[model samples]
Target chain A: MTARRFLSDLSLTVCGLAVLVFLLLPVLVVAPMSFSDAKSLEFPPPGFSLRWYQSLFGSDIWVEAGINSLVLATISSTIALVCGTLAAYVLTRGAFRGRRLLEANFMAPMIVPAIITAVAHYIAFARLGILGTFHGLVLGHTILAVPYVVLIMQAAIRGFDIRIEQVAATLGASRLTILARVVLPNLWPSAAAAWIFAFVLSFDEVVVTLFISGAHLTIPKRMFAELIIQVNPTITAVATLLIAFNLLALAVLLLVSRRGRLFERGY
Target chain B: MTLPGSYESGPVASQTVAAAHDVAAEATAVPARRRASLRQWELFFLLLPMLLLIVLIFDLPILNAAYWSISDPKTGALTLGHFRDFLDSTAYLRIIWRTFFLSLEVTAATILLGYPLAYWATKLPPRWRIVVLGLVVTTFWVSILVRTYAWIVILGSAGLINRLLMWAGVVSRPIEFLYNEFGILVGMTNVLLPFLVLPLFAAMMRVDMRLLQVAETLGASRFRIFWQVFFPLTLPTLAASAILVFILSLGFYITPAVLGGGRVPLVANMMDLLINRFARWETAAVVSVVLMVVTLSLYAVYQWLREKNA
Candidate 1:
């Protein structure tokens, strides 16, 4: 390559990596800052400390929100798993009229902007007198999570072997027995993906929840309130830990997929 | 109508159906009996929860919003007075315009910085490409709240950028960065850049490198080849990400509210304020409807453009 071309390539690579750094800067900054001793968002911290980490672990409000998010995510993911997986099965396995329209309806909530969802949900929940209730949170998060679960489940179900179920049927297995024994096992990876997706979505969701949420606060809703009201290092520690959680989850997902493929080869 | 996956089920299902029909011709035929009973039973059992969920959780709220917006005491008698009030109000109109322009600006920034990065990353070898993509995905997966907080640290009066600038003697006083339009732009662009980069990189990687090599063989300048050959092919990707980012920015609540420091009121934040502070639920609902209309119209236009080109 000519000198000019080499120079151009070098510059482009520099710019690209700089942008990559820009993308990663938030997590990188928060990760280290969580270890910092400063009360404020200070740079090149005077010293490292774990006081903020201890604060998060020690505080009742933070602990309660964390538990709330866990419970909410679990309930939401379970509902979404059942609903999305069943819909996926029907769409992929059952031959029916208006399936396209049915599928689109499942996806509509994903497209409708969150703020609008907040308003709509607020009105309905208010009328029902369930605003700020546990069931309301479950139902709301489930609606948000179902479409993602549906997308993943549909892809999984499309790759499924219907012949396995037919063969089981020939061996005198009932439909439910065939599903429980054959279909569910193959679709476990998809179910796992669905659960994680729903869980994370429920955990991260803030905007709509901020609107319709009652007195009971999830972690993100609490974080949103805390950020607006106070600038504290404890939240940074929480964020750093959340990043670690996501990494762990991603690693688990990789293992799940690898195991799934190995199981497919074996079966 | 025939089911979608029926033919793809191959002969196993067809043979079973034939066998079921051949056995007793009617009363005990497995396919017919199962079809009439199992299909309905299964459909009722399986599809009902999801169907009810979509209705109760998704549709009912939306219908409620629309209903209340029309029937509320302020806008009652089924009139468009609330919309007219919004249309008539100069402040509300400006908020809507500012939202559109801000979304446009952020989308443009992401594309401008994202294009070169996406292009170069696509040219990288596998190892480097994975590293680059790993960074981008981690950023994308991380919560927006965390990122917004980091910006507060970086843009604060005593934050990193100002501290460095002051230390360099460039400015004796710290420049205001957080809680302003500039901060909002920076925070939002930081968050949304990966949205543009990921999709654009995927599109860029699939481009025919041979086409560029052929153009090079034809003695076309590198710049000419990029502009005339490469960039045009990625226009659809560019347009698609631009609209997607813009629509997302339109509904942006957290970033602007946090970064704008209570000054820069985007429509979403304004709507929140109207509902929460002012108790103008009907007005807020109308604004949401307007945003939905605008976003859907843009999406429809995009769909039309895709179809027209096809």
Candidate 2:
């Protein structure tokens, strides 16, 4: 019985370790391949070089796409933050009928599949004659980003003490003033986390952007297009940078939320 | 008490009754009633901009798609031609069926792999548990496209796996692992694994350790204790995440497009082709509505399971 138990435990550990490797395989493989000297997708590289990184930097299209991705993510995430934060505050604090229904409406963009959103946006934007416009792209990305912001901010607001708002109101502050001052200032850490979440979401969005973005290029969109056509070593460099960027964002979020214990308070 | 000759008392008696009513209102629910209305208005104004944006951008487009699916695009006449086109075509049905089965396969794969990993994590020391789960989340944060792209390197003809196999003489030639159903399955299972693992791990942690201890003390074998107690407790979460993975897989665009190399066009890729490649807006709208309905229905079930577990 003892020997049998030992065997089972060993096998379970081995299986668990194997699955972890599988989960991390892409990240493990892609980062090293970016530094490979050989042109092909060779593992245990014959030699190490930074050629792919150099090529990625040298390419004008890549540089342009990077700028576009940054701008698009920044603008959309900011818009989502503003609109979603106010909506979240209302949804959490307001005594109103149909609040649940309205909250669902805000979250619908997230629950509905992205491909459906892509097709819907494609047809609607085409009919409105804004299919290829940057404004249309922003709108599409913002809709996707809004739900995350709403989710995060709603949780944060719910975690906040309502008595504080009542105290501010008792001090003769207007509703908007209390929200702008007492409420939002205390919720900045979560708001920042939500913004970063939305930013990463927009930065990585592909399906909707593919459908509606006529001439505009973002990193994921470009990488997707290139991937479907061919594999390039330069893509590994871009992928590595994206991995680093996302990890950095995640680290900042963890640090910010840890200091605030934003998640621990039910977020 | 009733006022005497109130009907005939004219303005004097009426003023007295009004004053009584005002005093009663002030003594009772009037302040709260007024505050509730005021708060509602504030909330309304706060919620308005987001409502308008969602209605105009998100809801309107979806409603527009539904309209397009059922109406004549050029003349705006109500017709069933688009949906009929979808229903009558075997090609569309074939792709839909293929998407269903592939999503099922991916869901099953994730559950099989994820269940063990989550279970194992539950048995680990706290520090190591965090390390293992952290790796899973870090992978989750990586781009789906980047992860999908990585598979081509690992599974391509001259890729890592093939090279390793050739070196060991495991096979005489490279097995074709790209641009097919097998490749799609592998890429998708890898991409969606974290979704299942994270939630399952949390649920596993929530399973009571005392129940296992009790079973063990009662002379339940290790296998019996786990199978009867621990696994059953975590089943709801496992089932919930499996549905989520299924729902996500049904609409997968990137994996099938890049890894499948257009050979196995899932519903998403098919929609992409209908709209972008062929400019068949009405047909794409029909496909969208169908996929949306299927996904939402499954999501409702997923939510129910989650609520049940909670």
Candidate 3:
């Protein structure tokens, strides 16, 4: 009996650890392979070099895409942050009809599949004559970003002490003034975390951008186009950079929302 | 049709009446209630900008797509021709069936691999639990495209697995792993494992330890204790995460596009072809509406299961 128990426990341990390795294999393989000297994708690199990084930097297309991605993510996430935060505040505090319905409407973008959104946007933007325009791209990304911002800010607002806002109201502070001075300042950490989340989401977005981004190219779109044509080592460099950027953003988010448990669902 | 339409509008008509009655009462109510109504208006003003943005950008696009799906392109007359075309064509149906089955396979694979990991994490010491979970979360943060791209490097002809296999003399030649269903499954399972594990781990942690102890003390074997006591407790969350994974896999575009190399076309890829390649906007709209309805229906079930777990 003891031996059977030991065998079962050992099997569970081995399987669990193997799954963990499998989960991390992509990160493990890509980061190391980025530095490979081999022309081909060779594992356990023959030698370390920055040729791929050099190529990635040397390419105008890649650099342009990177800039486009940065600017788009910045603009879209900022718009989403402003709009989503205010909507979340009203949704949380208001004693109004259709609040739940409105909240669901805001979150519908996130819940719906990206492909459907891509298709919908492709059709709609074609009609609006903004199919390839940068503003259209920003609007597409902002829609995607809004849900995360709303989710994060809603949790933050709910966690905040309503009594403090009430006290301010009782002490003759206007609602807007109370919000600016008392609430927004305290919710800054969570707001920052939500912004970072939206930024990462927009930066990493591919499907919607692929459909709607006519002339403009973002990093993922470029990587995808290159990947479809052939295997390029420079893509390894881009992937590595993206992984690093995402991890840094995640670290900052964790630091900011440590006390909030804002990520209870883990997206 | 009329029965269903009237049944739907029945409550809506009564709801309008009820709302008007409430408004009349509120207008006649005391000063504090009047002040509360004013605050509601203030909240509405605060909410208006975002609402306008959402309606213009998000809602309008989807509604427009639905309109396109049912309306004639030139004449602007309502029709079911696109949906009829969708049903008449076997290619679209084949792709839809393929997507459903592939998503099911991915969900099953995630549950098989993820459940044990979550259970094992619950058995670990506190410090080790954090380490394990952090690794999962880190993988979650990594871009899905990057993760999907790594599979090509790891599974391609001259890639890591093939190279190791050749070096070990396990095979005389490299295996065809990329641009196929096998590659899609592996990449998708890898990408989606965290979605299952994180929530399942949290759910496992929330399971009552005392009940398991009581079962053990009551002469229950470890196997029976786990299967009878622990597994049942975690089942709702397990079921919920499984549904969530399935829902995500159904909509997966990146992994299949990158890893499948266009060989295995899922619903999303099919939609892409319909819109971009085939120039069939109305058909794409039809496909999108179908996918949306299916996704939302499953999501309703997933939310129900999650609430049950809570």
Off by over 4 Å in 2: A259-267, B1-31
Which model scores highest in DockQ? Answer: 1
Clashing pairs in 2: none
Docking class of 1: acceptable
Compose the digit string of candidate 1's lDDT tens values, residues A115-234: 888878887888799888888888898999899888777777776655555555555666667667777876686578668867878888888788777898888898888888878889
TM-score of 2: 0.93
TM-scores, chain A, per candidate: 0.92, 0.96, 0.96
Q: After superposition on all CA atoms, what RMSD does each candidate show versus the true structure?
A: 5.3, 10.3, 8.5
All candidates: interface RMSD: 7.3, 14.9, 11.4
Summarize candidate 2's per-residue lDDT along B194-299 as a digit string, tens digits: 8898888888888889999999999999989989998999999999999999999999999999999989989999999999889999999999889888988999
For all candidates, state DockQ relative to the true structure: 0.42, 0.38, 0.40
Worst 10 residues of 3 chain B by lDDT: B1-10
In candidate 1 chain A, where is summed lDDT lowest over 10 consecutive residues?
Answer: A258-267
User: Which docking category, incorrect, acceptable, medium or high, applies to candidate 3?
Assistant: acceptable
Residue-level lDDT of model 2, residues A1-267, one tens digit each, is 999989999999999999999888888999999999998888766789999999999999999999999999999999999999999998988866788889888999988989999999999999899999999999999999999899888877887766556655655567899899878887787888899989999999999999999999999999998998889989999999999999998888877666323211230
By the DockQ metric, which is better: model 2 or model 3?
A: 3
How far residue A111's Cα lies from its native spot in candidate 1, in Å, is 1.4
